[model samples]
Target: MKVTHNTAAGTFTLTGKMWSNTYPLDQLDAWLAFYRRQRDEHPKSGNSYDKGIAGLGRCRHSSRPRPADQLALRAEGQAGACVRVLGRWAEAVSRGKG
Candidate 1:
């Protein structure tokens, strides 16, 4: 799977049979978190994490953030956390846990 961050567009584009979803920055954390948790709890489960990510991608798109952008700014930290979690999950999966 290939996931690219288009800074110009502020979007994440994931492409592959297993990961074909365009995820907005706003909802990236939730998607990463749900998949990470499932992977952590069931490392050996085949494709659960993949399925979770895909399922999240299929969910209705999140509405744009409200004009009060303070809350969204505060949640910027979550974006980093999500990246870390996704990294670990990917490493584990690559090592054959899944």
Candidate 2:
């Protein structure tokens, strides 16, 4: 996956294997800030997204977030889901599951 920021548009473009998505920078930043707060407040939990913070969960039409869930991209809460996807991808790589 690749992520690029467009300062002019104030958005982030996330390009994955066969799909791409654009999200408002403000929304993404807001969700990251929330994730940081959650991590700091619960250090023992180690920044787990499984609790569904900021509406992290399966998409309405599927059991999990996917490129096909374009509807979720319109929701502010789903901004965090993008971060969560990146987080999970990192974790999988670290564990040699990617």
Q: Compare the candidates by TM-score and give the number of the best one.
A: 1
Clashes of each: 0, 0
Query: Global CA lDDT of candidate 1, please?
Result: 0.53
Q: Which pairs in model 2 have colliding backbones? A: none
lDDT of each: 0.53, 0.49
Q: Which runs in model 2 stand beyond 4 Å of their true positions?
A: 30-98
lDDT of 1 by residue, 1-98 (tens): 44445322346665677657787766666766777788778879877467547544543233222222432443345776445444544555677752
Total backbone collisions, model 2: 0
Best by lDDT: 1
Q: Per-residue lDDT of 11-77 in model 2, one digit per residue for the tens?
A: 6655557998777755665644565577778889864643434332122122222342442453335
TM-score of each: 0.39, 0.31
RMSD of each: 15.6, 14.4
